[model samples]
Target: MAEPAPHGTPRRYRHGPCHCDLCRAAHAAAARQRRRDKAYGRYRPDVDAEPVRRHVRKLREAGLPLPQIAALADLNRSTVSTLLHGRPPQGVPPTRKMRAVNADKLLAIRAEQWIGAAS
Candidate 1:
């Protein structure tokens, strides 16, 4: 026989097909958290990428290479490359949205700082 599902888990309420009190409470709590997150504007974790793309272009124009820009922005090298050149072959467009935290990080970099440092 299969082992019984653990108590106090939404998983038990869902896949376990168990509707016991603990499972129901867990499911309700999960639902409440989701509702609160949505109400607090935390549900959408991404922002439009256009502004970050523009900033990257500006930084490039200021003579900062892609790798350097990635380093300054504390982002992945591939992430900056993909933003500028897109994927290979099909050359997929830069993603339409990026995580809000990444966008903020990239946007925080100032082109003038690099331009001054490069000189």
Candidate 2:
């Protein structure tokens, strides 16, 4: 048996992505909790869109095609095109919701790319 953690210390390891029925139930429960947190606006992602925008701009500067950037980010061509060239929504009367698809993941992917480049 593993030794217990000190008081106020977080668990080093306990539950994880395992295949047993109990582990699967735990995984499902955690996922549901995450979804609920997101729905309730209680979860804030660590990365935002600025890094993604910077990375895309760099790629564009290097003359990479939109399709290439999209592939690198695991985003669709339309999304990469939109990210690069689409004007920000503005209106005196109205416009659509401001959510940018795949932006968060793009940020994460770009950060990872930077790490890889640095090393």
Candidate 3:
């Protein structure tokens, strides 16, 4: 008989005696990804960039300056300016709604750039 998990407690995996290389690597990778996501503020890749853009636009239409808009949006002033000027943010690529897909695409792009530079 299995012990009942405490209220609102998540069940732990019971991969008893299973110290496979693949599982270990997967766990390590997951931990690394979590750290990277936290460090890079990559929490939500597909956070509807349109909403942010629209917010900036509305603020601009309301006569707010670029700096004010940036402050309100918690973004850089140049980013707000670029968006107003119909340009994407520098250094960061466009993101899809699916976070995993967006992250994968970003990683792939970075990898390609690194490989190209090394070649």
Question: Which of the numbered candidates is closest to the native, going by highest TM-score?
Answer: 1
Q: Candidate 2 on 20-113: residue-level lDDT in tens?
A: 5555555567568769989998865534445566767776675666676677667656555555555344212211222344665554444345
Tens digits of per-residue lDDT, candidate 1, 33-97, equal 77998999877567989889998898888788888889988887877877777666655677688
How many residue pairs clash in each candidate at the backbone level?
A: 0, 0, 0
Candidate 3 lDDT by residue in tens digits, 4-95:
32222121112232335655555566668778988999754444445445554554565666665455445545444544453343343432
Q: After superposition, how far is residue 69 of candidate 2 from its true place, in Å?
A: 0.9
Against the reference, the lDDT scores of all candidates come to 0.81, 0.52, 0.45
Cα lDDT over the full model 2: 0.52
lDDT-better candidate, 1 vs 2: 1
Candidate 3: clashing pairs of residues: none
TM-score of each: 0.60, 0.40, 0.36
Return the lDDT, model 1, position 76: 74
Error of 3 at 87 (Å): 4.3
Among the numbered candidates, top lDDT falls to 1
